[model samples]
Target: MSTEQIPEGVRLAPAMVAGARIYIPEPTWCDVDHASENASCVQDVDHRTAPAYLNRPGSDIESLLHVEGFAELSGAHADPVVMLNDATAMHPAQALRWAKDVVAFAEKVETIARSVMPELEA
Candidate 1:
């Protein structure tokens, strides 16, 4: 994708990290799209606050654009009406297909990252 092709209401910036930290995830709400048979959600819903580990260089790196599907919910604000546990019902065949999708997505993220941060590539 070209710079001009980025989503309209999106912004990107660079920042320097100082130390290790953890972040709490914000709740995400989505409605089921009947036409596509998928959830209508936002991006970065599955991304970790800290994308890399500074303490251990080259540690098991994750895709910057990580994607995850919701399975269960807990806590005071948990909604029994919305949360689904269908992920538990995934068959071995489905798991394999999902794994292949994740691999493809990671490759796309790597390509985009390289295009934007060519200097950071080793």
Candidate 2:
């Protein structure tokens, strides 16, 4: 038999917050008919995660993930894109917000990586 590790080189650290639910903060929703059918395919996470980890004041992605929301959400679910659109329809503001969030998040991550891996300068 084979066993799999959680993949974190570092053990679970205290005071470390997981932002799994922030990316998709809207609650488990139903289709227009208000049915839970479409939601079945989506995995439901603990409700506590959103309130505790998500829900930040910053309008940008860093504000959205200043505490590591991006990492957790990506790690937690596999098909968030499909799930997000399928879960519930988003308005224009949602689209705009997401775009801004992603751009800001990418810039910050790139900056951090460049700092850590100075070889990027080459």
Candidate 3:
């Protein structure tokens, strides 16, 4: 048997539901109806708002990620377009806070990465 290794910095969001960690990327907001039913709520994370990580043009980390969110919802899931590359998680909301949070978290990661590998900016 084979199993996929969860990426580094990846973690199960504390606010996850539906017996699954996946959140639907549609709707652009958390579904109170679904949450009231104790179902999964889609948390959209837009990392594009963070310009620090993008400072290093052509960087793999920069191109590999974007402003997006992920939720398993069920056994069937979709690959996250932008992996925060950190262990932080956030709840779904209609405000830009989620997107800002993703960017902030990503920036923190970049800061740590630069501290260890200064060449990351080159």
Candidate 4:
């Protein structure tokens, strides 16, 4: 890939894709341990962010969120998406809007928590 085609903060690195040697862009936030002998780094010609999680209070439930960007060569699915755990995928714009809603809900939760425990700090 040409320097002009690379995204900011990404570096091209050699990898085996579909039994052929190719260079893949690795972003700064990528958590794939490419050095591992058994690493499964490639994901359908896409790069992904490290997973972020939010755990429920007093419960084992945890929610995961991550972003995935498909390589330009990925054909029809070249657009980036925000993945919610393993369940949903949203475009960046949609994810931004959904994030606003999540912030509002979190604020409401904080309010309720404070009402129940006045000394609680968010």
Output the number of the lDDT-best candidate. Answer: 4
Instruction: Write candidate 2's Cα lDDT for 1-122 as tens digits.
Output: 11253342222221212422122322232111112223322233212112112334553333332221111222443222212322332343565687688789879988999999989863
Q: Give the clashing residue pairs of candidate 3, or none.
A: 9-86, 22-71, 22-72, 23-71, 23-72, 46-67, 47-67
**lDDT tens readout by residue for model 1, 1-122:** 45575555323322222322222223233322222222233221221122112233355553323332332224332322211122243433565686688679879978898999888755
TM per candidate: 0.30, 0.29, 0.26, 0.64
Q: In candidate 4, what are the lDDT values of residues 59-78, reduced to their tens digit?
A: 55654443343223255445
Per-residue CA lDDT of model 3 for 1-122, tens digit only, reads 11254444442333335555443223233223332334433433321222223325656654533333444433322333333433333343532575777679989988998999998754
Compare the candidates by TM-score and give the number of the best one. 4
Displacement of residue 60 (Cα, Å) in model 4 is 7.0
- 10 residues in a row with least lDDT, candidate 1: 44-53
Residue 83 miss distance in model 3 (angstroms): 16
Ranking by TM-score: 4, 1, 2, 3
> Candidate 2: worst 10 consecutive residues by lDDT?
65-74
Error of 3 at 52 (Å): 20
Could you tell me how far off, in angstroms, the CA of residue 9 lies in candidate 4 after the best superposition?
Answer: 6.6
In model 1, what is the error at residue 67, expressed in angstroms? 12
Candidate 3 overall lDDT versus native? 0.41
Model 1 C-alpha lDDT versus the unseen true structure: 0.37
Instruction: Give the residue spans of candidate 1 off by over 4 A.
Output: 1-88
In model 2, which runs have C-alpha deviations exceeding 4 angstroms? 1-85
Candidates in descending lDDT order: 4, 3, 1, 2
Clashing pairs in model 1, backbone N/Cα/C closer than 3 A: none
> How far does residue 2 in candidate 2 sit from its true spot (Å)?
66
Q: Each model's number of backbone clashes?
A: 0, 0, 7, 0
